[model samples]
Target: MGQAGGGASQAQEPTGLNKLQHIRRRCTCLLPLAGWLMTCAVHAQSAPTQSDFGGAGLLQTPTARMADEGEVAFTASRTSPYTRYNFTLQPLPWLESAFRYLNIANVPYGIVPNSNSQSYKDKSIDVKVRLWPETHYLPAFSVGIRDLGGTGLFSSEYVVGNKRFGSMDASLGLAWGYMGNRGDIANPLDVLSDKFKIRPGGFSGTGGNFNTSHYFRGRPAFFGGISYQTAWQPLILKLEYEGNNYKHEPFKNNQPQRTPINVGAVYRLNRGVDLSLALERGRVAMFGFTLHTNLAESPGPTKLLDPPPPVRTQTPPTQTPQQVDWSAVSTELRSNAGIEVSKITRRGREVLVTGEQQRYFYPAKALGRTARVLDNQLGADIDWYTVVATREGMPIVATSVHRQRFDDLLDYNIDLSTFRRSVEQDTPLPQREEVLYRATPKKFDGGFSLGFSESLGGPDAFVLYQVSADYDANYHFTPNLWWSGGFSANLLNNYDKFKYDAPSNLPRVRTYVREYLTSSRITMPTFQLTTSRQLGTDLYGLAYAGMLESMYGGVGGEVLYRPMGERWAIGADVNWVKQRGFDQDFSFRQYHVATGQVTGYFNLGYKDVTLALSAGRYLAGDWGTTIDVSREFRNGVRMGAYATFTNVSAAQFGEGSFDKGIYISIPFDLMLPSSHVRSANIMWQPLLRDGGARLNKRYTLYDLTSDRDSDLFQDNLQQITE
Candidate 1:
C-alpha cells in the first residue's frame, strides 16, 4: 500500500500542475507578438495606428485609446492553441465592443470520432470603456473585461493606458484572473474579502455572471509594451513584456518562454489593411491581418439619383385649371417621389393621392417630399394634401397635411416641433366618378443576389460554407399585401464533410443541420404571402403563411402597440410550425410545435442604446426569456449582444451552458454615396442547442413600422431639404 501510494502521488503532481482546463472555461489564444502594439480597443474620437489590431505585442491586450466614431474592424490571428476571429466596433468616443470566436485547435468539441477534425469554437464578448481621454501630457486610460460569458476559458480583467510621443506609442497595464499569472504581486482586492485572496481554479456556476469576487484578486501582474515608427513610414517596430509566466496555463500546458521579451513588426499592405508578424515568448511565430474601415469616412462609389427637382421654392399656381397636363405630373411623381399613383381625385378643398409607396422607407418622408412636388404643380386652390398609403390592397392610415404647413416644414420656414402637430389622419372616402387622374398599378418586381453562405461554431464542424445564388421576386396583388419568394442554388460547398450528432440530453432539434446542408443543392429558403396593416393609431397587425425559413413551414400572426414618436413599444407574436425535411424543399418532418412571445422594446435614448426583451414558449418546448441590448451609431452601425435563459439547466442544455450571441447590424448606405434600404445583420451564436429557440417568424410589426419613431427623420433631416 505504501509503494502504490508513493507512485500515485508522483503521477498526480504533474497532472494537476499541467491540466488543460480551457475546454470547460472559455478558450483563448494568447498569440500577441514581437513588439507590443496595443492600440486602442475602440476606435472613436481618435485616429487609427499600425497596430489597430493583431500587432507585434499580446494579441488580446488593449491600450487606453479609441478609434474614431463609426469605425468597424475585422481581425484574424493564430497561435498554437487558438485561432481567433474578432469583430470590433466603436460606437462612441468612450466605448468599444467586440465579438470573438476562439477556435481551440487542440480539443474536440465532441468525444466520439467524426470525419471532420474540427476544433472547439467558443464565443466571447469584449468591452473597453475609456476612463480618460489621451492628451499631449497625460496618457489615455481604460478598463475592460474579456470572456464575460461562454465557458470562461480566458476570463480576465485589466486597467490599461497608452501614451504617444512623436513616432512611438507606449502602453502599460495591470491584469488579474487569466492574465495575472506572471509576476506575483499583492492582491489589492483582498482588503474587501478574504475569499478573494486566492483565485478559484474553475467557476462553480454557469458562465455569463460578472465573477466579481475573483476580479483584481489573486496574484496581480503588470504588462506593458511599445511600438516605434521606423524611417520607412509604412513599417512599425514592436516590443512588449508581459506579466504571465505561463506556469498555470489552462489545460496543464505551460508554454516555455526562453525570454520575457517579445518582438515584432508590421507592414502596411494597403490603405485599410495591415499585415503583422511576431516572435512570441522567444519561441512561437505568430501572424495575422486586419481589415478596418471608418464607415462614416468610407469612400465607396456613390449611388447616383436625380436630385429632387432642385428643391423647388416657387409659389403655387392659382387656377381651377382643367387643361393641366396630368400625365406629365404622373411622370414627375415616378421620377422624383417614386410613387405609383393608382388614382388622384379632388374632394372639396382636399386632394387625395391614393397609391403604393415604392421608393422611400417611410411614408412620412415620402409624403413630405411628394407634397413639394404637388406644390410646384397644383393650383393654390388645393389646401389639404391627403396621402393614403397601402401595402396590399388594404389601406394603411391616411395622413392628411395642411398644404401650407407641409411647405413650411419642408422649407424650414416653420419649426418641426409645431409643424408635426398640424398633420392628422382621416378615414378614406369612397372612389367616385370625380377621379381626375389614374395610372396602371405595377404588378410585379424582382431582383437577383449572390453571396457566400456560412455557419460557424457547430459541433459537427467548426465552419461550413457554400457559394450560393438567389433569384428573388415579389408579386404585388394590390399595394400592402405581396407574395415574396426566393430560389437558391448551391454553386459549391463542402457540407458533405459534416457528419456528427453532438452528445446531448435535450431533443436534437438543431443537430440535423449537417443533413440539411448536404441534402439540398437547390432550395427555396423563403416563400410566403405576407399581409400587414396599421390597425389603429398605435396598434399594428400582420399575418403570413407558407415556408418561413430553411427549416420550417409555418403560419403566424403578430400584433404590436407602438405610439408615434415614442421610444418604447410592446408586441405579441404566435406561430404553429411543422418542421421541414432535410431536403429544404416543400416537405415536412415529424417534429412540430407552436411557439409565441410577448416582447417589449425600449429605446433608452442614451448613446443610441436600445433594449429588447421577450418571454414565451420556445420551439423546443422550453420556457424562457431573452434580453437583447444594442448601441447604434450616427453612421447607422449597430453592435449588440443577447442572452436567452430557459428553465432547462446548464447540464441539460449542454456545451454552451446557455444560448448567447453577439451581433453587428450595419446599413449598407453608410458606406455608399447614396442610401439604399438594406442592412446586413451578422450574428455569432456559440452553439446550436435546442434550448430557448424561437420560431423564425418572417415579419415582425416593430421592424416594419420603424418609421413611426421620429428619430430616423430627425437624424437625417438634410435629406428632406431636397
Candidate 2:
C-alpha cells in the first residue's frame, strides 16, 4: 500500500482529562485497540488517538473502520518519487472524505521547465462510506473511490472489510484502476457488460471531472494487510500484500516490484503524534508522521472573568424602574455577554431592553443573563424582562421572558415546554414614550484582520500562496443604515511563478486571476453602503451599493422571508456590476453584466445538516442551479460541499467538467471565546472556470439575522447559565 504524510493524533474533549482515572479502571473488548497510551502491563488505559493512511486507513488502502466523527487529520508521508500531503475529515460515523496533494518528484512541472526539473503535484479527492458494521461474526465492510475527482493519475475503486480480534486488526480488499495495475485477476463484472472487459488508458488530458462512468470497469486484484499489537503498547507491527505492481507510475515511468509483501512498524511518541517506517518492494524505505485533533470537542477557553453574577439564592430588594442604575447594568452586560445596549424602557410590569450582539455566540445566554441582572436589581413585582435582539440597530426579534420562571429554566429545574410557555417571541412595532434610556450609535468602528488566498495543482506551479493584512471599518448613520469598507495589502506571495495559463475556449471571466493577484500589493476589495429593515413579521430587506469585492463593483438588494421558528426559508437577490481592473484602483473593465438568484434553504433535522438550492443567471451569462449541503457541529465547525450545474456543456465548461468543491469553516470562539467575532473558511475547488462564476458579494441578510430560527436557542440550551 502507498502511504504518506503521517505524524500524530490526539483527540480529547475539554473535560476528558477528568475521565482518565475511570478509563484506567476498566478494560473492555475494544481496550486492546486503544491500549497505546499505557505500557502493555497496564492495558486498561485507552489511547485517545487514531492513526490513518488515505484518510481512514492503515497504509495505502482503505478499511471498513472509520475515524471518530468530527475527527480531523493532516498527513505528510514519503517513500521516494511520490510524496503526499492530505487532509482528512470524518463528519459522520459512516463517511470519510479527504483532499490530497500528490507530488511526483520524478515528473517535471511542465514540458518547458522554468529552471531545474521540478516535481509535478496533482490534487485528488477520495471518499469512503461504510455499508455494514462489524458484529460478533462479521467484519465491517465499506466501498470507496480514490483519485476519482481531479487529475486521475492515481484513480481507482475498491471494497474492503476490517475486523479486530484481541490485539490485532486485519483488512482485505479488491481494487481496480491504479490500485490493480498488476491485473492479477480477470475482469469480474465482464458478464454485465462488454465495456467492463477492458480498462481505459488514462483520464482526459484536461482534468477536473467527476467521471463516474469509468468506476469498477477493469480487471480486479486482491490486497490485504494485518496489524498486531506488540508486547509494548504504542508499537504495532504490520504486514501487507499489495495489489498493484507499479507497472504504470505517474509521468509514464514504471516502478520495479521486488515482491508483493510489505512489512512496517508504527510507534506512538505522544498522544498527538505517531512515527512510522516501512519497507516497500523490499527496496524502498518509507517513513512519515501525522497530526490530528477532534473538531467535535475541545477545551473551552480558560480565562477568568466576573463569575456570571452568582445565580442568586434569594430574591433581592425592590427598586423603582427609574432608579435601576443604567450605567452599571450596561457595564455588566458588556463584561459578561459582549452585548451593546441601545435602548432600555419600562412599560408597567414589563421592561424592554434592546441591544446588538457582539460577543456571545449564543443570544440565549445573553438573553438569559440579562434576565438575571433584572432579577437582582428589581423586585418580584416586575413580572417580565423582554430583549429586543437587534442587528445593525434594527429589531429582529422581541423575546419576552417571565423573570421568575427564567431563573428556574436556566438552572435546569424546569422542562422546555413549561419554560417556553413563560416566554413570548414577537416582532415589535413603533413605540412612543416607553424608552427610558437611549444610546447614541457609534458613527465609526474598525478592526484589523489577516487572511490567505491560495491555489494548487496547475502546470505552472504546485502551490501559490498569498497572505494579506486587511483594515475594515463601518460607519453607522442610523441603527438600520451604515457604510462599510476594507482594504487589504499583500504581505507575502508566490505569484511570480504564475506564468502559464491553461488552455481555455470560454470567456476569460476567471482566466485573469494571476493579473489581479500581481497587479498591486494593496487593493480595495470592498467599499459599500448598506441598509437593513424588517419588511414584515417574517420578512427582511437589504440594499447595498459600491465595490462589492476584488473582482466586481455593483449595486444590489435582497429580500428574505424566514418564519419566526421554522426549518425553511426563501429569498431573492439581484446585482449589476462591471469587472474591476487588475490594479483594483477604481477603474472598471469593459465586461459588464447583471445577475441574480432565487434561493431556498431547508433544515434536514439530522446532525446539524442543511440544504440550500439556488437558480439564477451567472456572471458569464450561464444559467444554472447550485446545490449546497452543509453540517455545523455544536462546537461551531462547519463542513460543506457544493456543486453547480448549468446549461453550459462539459467541453464549454473548460478544465472543470462542472463546478464543485468542499469547504470547512472554523470558528475562532472554539479557541478564544472571549476574543472571537468571526469564523475562518477555506475552500478547495478543482478549477475556477467561467461557466458558473458569481459575483463575490460582501453581505447577506440571512446570515445577519439568524437568531430568528428556533434551533439557534435549542443548540445552546446547556450554556444558558455559563
Candidate 3:
C-alpha cells in the first residue's frame, strides 16, 4: 500500500516514493483501456439470475454475465447424492465469488476411523471475473476457476462468453478437470507445453492447498446453455448441455449418465427470493431456493423511534445570554442532538460546546441538529457555534458553523452550497474560556443482550451451536479510564456433539476450541481495565490488562498515528499473554507466549475498498504476514476477507494450508427503528488451526477515534437535513 501524507510517511522507507511513482504510471496507462471498456459496456435489461451452482449462469454451466455489485445471496440445492450449501457475493462490478459446502450422502466423513458418523463434507471456493463487456455486436467474455485452493475433486477452469438476443441469453464454454472428464476435445494448451496434456491426480497431503500446478490440465470438453424469459414475468426456463459424463466422481462413487442434457425452471417468489427445479443426467431431480439482496443501495428500515431534528424558528431570538435556560439547552443537546455534554463555554461572539456524539453514525447529522437547538435557545448575539467533539476525555475534531448562515440555509434564504462554504473543521486544541455550564459525567453503564456461537464442517457433527443470554457492564472512573466485563449464561446448546479435537504440532494456542466450547454452561469471556489518551495531535494510545478474551488473559498496549483527512494510518501493538483455562474463568494454563504486530491501513480510492497489511509474531510463536481487504457499501454495510501466510510449512499448518476468513458488518440502525453507531459483525473461518492467530483485542485506536475522519460525515450527508 502506498503511504498517504502526514504520519503515514514515517511508516515508509525512502524507496516508497519510487514505488508510488511506478504505481501511478501504471494506473495512468490503464485509463484508456478502462474508458474503452466503459464505452462498450452493455446495460442489462434485468437483474442477472443465479445458477444452480450459486452464480450467474444457466442450469449447470456458468455464463459470462455479472451480477450487480454488493449483491449477497445464499443458495441451497439437493440433487440425488449431492447436496450443496453456497454463499455468494458480488463485491465488485466485474467480480463474483462463492464459498460452498458439498455433502456426499453416500460417503462417510472418513476422518474418524471405525466410526460411521457424519456425511462427507467438502469445502471449496470459486471466483469469476468479466474480461469484456458485451456490446451491440460483441459477446461478453469471462474467465473463472472453480473449487480453487481445495481438494482436486471438483476443480475446473473455464473461459465462457454470453450474448443476449431479445428475451434469450446464450452461453458457451470449454471446461477442464471434473467438468471436462468426458474428454470430448483435446487440450488446447498442449501446443504451448506438452505438460498440459499430462494432468496430475489425487489429493495431496491433507488438502486445502491451491494446487495451482494442476489447473487447466488434462482433457477438455465443451458446454453450452441458454436461458429464456417467458411471457409470464415471474418465470424463466433453462436448457444446458453437460460438460462431464460422470465417468468419475469423488470417493469413487460415480453414477451412470444416460444423457448430457439438463433442463430447469426458475420462479421468482418475490424480489428477494427465487425457487428452482431441474432434471439432470435425464434421471435425477433437483430442487433449490435462493435468498438475495443488494446491500449497497438498499434503504434500511425507517427510523420511526428517533426524535425529529429541532425545529427552526421563523423569527430571530431576542433573549440575552443570562436569560437563556442553559440547563435546558444542555438537555436538548443530549436528547435531540445526541451529544453528551461535558461543558458549555463562551468566548466573545462564539459559544463552544465540548461533548461526545453517542447516537448518530454520521457527525453531520449531530452538528446540523445542534445548530438548530442553539439557534432556538440563544440570542442573536451568539454569532458562531463551535463543537469540540470528544471520544473518551480527549478532544478529536472541532467543527465551527456560522450561525446566521446555518439559519439562512434552514429557512430557504441560502442554498446548501453557500452554507457549506461557511463551515470550518480542524483538530481540537485545549483553550481557556468563560465556562457557562460544566455537567458531571455519568459513571456507570450496562446492558443485556443475546449471543450465539456455532462450528461447522466438523467430522463429529455437521454443526454444533449455542445460544446464550449475555450481560455486559462498564464502570468509568474517569472519561479515559474504565473497567469492562461480560458474562454469558447458556440458554440452549447442542455443544455435546462437539467431540473432535484436532492435534497440533505447535503450542496449541487455538486448536483447543472444542474443549473451550464444551467446558462450561456459564462463562465469563472478558474482564478488563483499559485507559486511553490523545498523545499528540494525530497520535492516540490505549492500554489494557486482565482477561482480554475467552481463551487468553493478557496485558497489551497499542499506539496509532492517523493524520486528519489522510487516506492512510499506521499502528503497532504488543501483548504478553498466558492461556486461560477451558472453564473460561480466572484460572490460567501453563503455556505462555509474546505476540506483536505492526499494521498499516490504506483506503484505496476505488469502490470504497480498503486494505490492511500486518506483519507479526503469532500466538504459536510463528511469524507471518496477514492481508485484509474490505469494501463499505453506501448503506454502511461492510464486507471483507483476510488471509495469513506464515513461515511454517503447509504440512505444519495442517488441513487448511493457511488461515483465512471472511466477515460482514451490519450497522445496527439498518434493522432497528432507532439511530445507532454500533454494528454487528458476522465472521466465517473455514478451519481453525494453531498458526497465524492474533489476540482478539477488545479496543483499537482506529475504531475508537473513527469520528475524527471527515469521510463519515461526507458519505452520509443526506442525514444533515433530517
Candidate 4:
C-alpha cells in the first residue's frame, strides 16, 4: 500500500513549485513566437509616413507609396497664410482619398452680404491610385489628382514614383496647375490637345462640381524628395524640391520664395500620432501633426467583462427533460451566452432555444456559447441544438448544430469544415413544440448621451457648434412594438453667431439650419411609435409615426426583401412629412411634402464593398437619385461616400451645387472593453443645401434585419470559441 501511494503521488499533475516549472517550460516554448510578433510590430511601424497634406508622402509632395488599406488619418498643418485640416482614408490597398478644408488667413470670407469677415475657407477632395508596386530594380508608380472637386485655386494632377533603398526613400513627380506654377516645362499632354496648354482661369461654379476640364492643364514642373529614417526609430528626416513657385498662389496672393528646396522632420509621439515641422520654399515655417490608425489591423482590447465559457472536465451524466431545471438553464443561457431567452422548447432529441442576442456582435459566437451552456444543463438524449435568432419579436433565422459534431470541434477531433458540414441554417419552422420555459422582458429602456452638432465653413464663422444634453427613452408595449422619444437641452453653444442663411431657389427644406440652431434652447428631436413585423420568409416591414426628426414630423413605412445569406437586398420607403417650426416645437410650417425612394443595395463581394442606389423625391419636392458606396474593414469599421443629384439646377442649389458627404462608422466594441453591437457614426457634409434633402427616418427595415445575414457569422467562425 505504501509503494502504491508513492506511485500515485508521483503521477499526480504538477502543483506548487512543479506547476511553476511547467509554466516556465510553456513560456520557454513561446519565446520564439513572442520574438516574431515583436519583430512584425517593429516592421509595421516602418510604413510610409503621412505628409502635411495627408496621405503617404514627404512634406507637401506625395509619393507612390500608400498606407495600408482601411487606414484612417486626420491631419492638420499651418504654413503662414494657409491652415489645412485634412481627413484621409485608405479604402483599398492601391487607393487613397482625402478631403481637406483650407483656411486662408489673409483672405476675407466675402463682402457686405456675408455675415462676418471670418477667414476664407475652401473644401477640396483628392484621390490617388497606384499604377504598380515597386520591385527589386523598379520604383512604385502612382497617379493622382489634387483638389478634385472645388474651386480651381489649388487644382493639380501628377504622376509620381517612389523607390526605397534600405533606410532611404526617394520620390519624383511631374505636376501641373498650382504645383507647376514654375512653368519649367511645356505641357506634356499638349500633343494630345491644345486645351492642355492653357488651363481654365478663375474658380468653379459655386464650388462642389467636379471641374474635370481644369485637370492636367498648363505647364508642368518636376518635383522630387528624399526621406531618411534614422537609427532612432521615432524620427525621420526629409528633403524635398517642390515644383511650384509661390507667385501663382490662390487669389493671386503671391508669396516670396528664396528657393524651391523644402526640409522637414517628423517625430513619432506614439503608435498613432506623428508631429512634423517643415521649412517650405525656404521662406515659410510649417508645422503639422497626424493622428492615424489602421482599422483593419485594430482588433481592440480583450473582452475582460465577458463571461467565460463553462468548462467541463468530463461529459456529465445526461438527465431526462423532465428531470432538468429549465429555469436554471434559461438563466444560465442569458447570463453566460448573452442570449435573451424568450422561450425554451424541446422536440424529440433536439432542444430548441428561441431568443435574441443582445450583447454579441456575431450571432454564431452567441449560438456557440449557447450550445455549451445547453450541453452542461441538458440530458444526453439531446443530439441537436437549434437556436432561433429573433429581432424584435420576429424570427429572423434558425441555426441548427449537431451536438456531437460541436463537441468534436471543441475537442479538436474534427476540423471547422467537418463541423460546419453538420451545421444548418434556415427559416424557423411554423410548427409549435412543447415549451419548457418563457421569459418576461423588462418594460422600459432609456439613456442619456452628450450630443454635439456643428456647421463648418459657414459665412458667420469657420465653425458653428452646439453642445447639448440628450435624454432618450423607449417604452416597450410588446415584443415587437415600442414608443420612442428623445429631448435635448442646450448645455453650451455658440449658435448666437449663426446669422447667415443660404439662399435657395427651391423650397427651403434644409437651408433653414441657421434658424433651427439659434431659435431653440431646448428641443424635442424625436417622438415616435415604432413597430416591425416579419412579412415573409425573407421580407421584413417597419412603420413609425410622430416627430421623425428635429426639423420634420410625420409618418413613414419601410419594407425590405433580403434573402438570408445573400449579398443583395432591396428596400423601399415612403413618408408624408411636414416641416416643424424653427423653435422645434409641435407647431408646423407651411411646407409639407410626400417623399419616397426605391433603394437597391448590393454587396460586390470584392474587398467587402457595398453599393446603394436610391431614386427618390427630395424634401424640396425635387426628383433625384443618390449613389452611396461603402467598404467595411475586418474590425467592423466602415467608410462611405454619398452624392445626391436632383432635377434642380446647380445655380438653384446655391453654394455646394448639390448634396454630397462622407461618413465613418466605428463599432463601439473596437474602443471599449465590453462587447457591443452598436457603432458610433461620424459624418462630414461640405454644405447643407435645400437640394436633394431626404427625410431622416428614425429606423429602417434593412438595419433591423441585419442579423438575418449569415456572412458575418461565417467570416468570424473562429471567434465562436472565444
Per residue, candidate 3 scores C-alpha lDDT tens digits across 1-722 of 11100000001111111010111112222223233222222222255777767788877788999888877777889987989888788888899888888888998887766436678877777889999899999899999998888777788888899999999999989988887788887899999999899678887545568888888899989998999999998899999997998878888889888899999998977676778999999999989987777766655567799998888777878986667788889999999989999999888888988998889876878888998888887887899999889877878888898998887777789877777788888888766788888888879889886665556777776776556678888998999999988887878777666556666677888777667766897888889999999999999999999998878998999999988878888999999999999998999999999998898988898877878899999999999999888877766767777788999888888877787666555565655568876654545566777888777776777777666667666677556667
- Model 2 regions lying over 4 Å from their true place: 1-53, 111-117, 305-315, 409-433, 673-675
Pairs that clash in candidate 4: none
Q: Whole-model Cα lDDT per candidate? A: 0.64, 0.70, 0.77, 0.77
Q: Score candidate 1 by lDDT.
A: 0.64
Superposed on all Cα atoms, the candidates' RMSDs to the truth, in angstroms, are 10.1, 8.1, 8.8, 12.8
lDDT of 4 by residue, 1-722 (tens): 00000000000011010000100012112223223222222223645787777778898889999988877777899998999888888888999988888889998877226644787888887899999999999999999998877777788899999999899999999998887789889998999989999988788748877887888888899998999999998999999998989887888889999999999999987667788999998989999987776766766667898888777547675777777888888888888788888898988888899988878876777888988888877767889999998877888889999998998899999998778788888878677587888888757889887665655776676666666777888898998899988888877777576656566698988767667766888888788989998888888899988988778999989899988878899999999999999888888999999998998888898988888888989899999999888887755667777889999888998777777776666565666567876654555667777788778665666666766657667766777677
CA lDDT, candidate 4, residue 126? 86
Kindly give the stretch of ten consecutive residues in candidate 2 with the minimal lDDT sum. Answer: 1-10
Cα-based TM-score, every candidate: 0.81, 0.88, 0.91, 0.91
Better of 2 and 4 by lDDT: 4
How does residue 664 of candidate 1 score in lDDT? Answer: 54
Query: Model 4: residues >4 Å from true position, as ranges?
Result: 1-44, 111-117, 313-317, 415-418
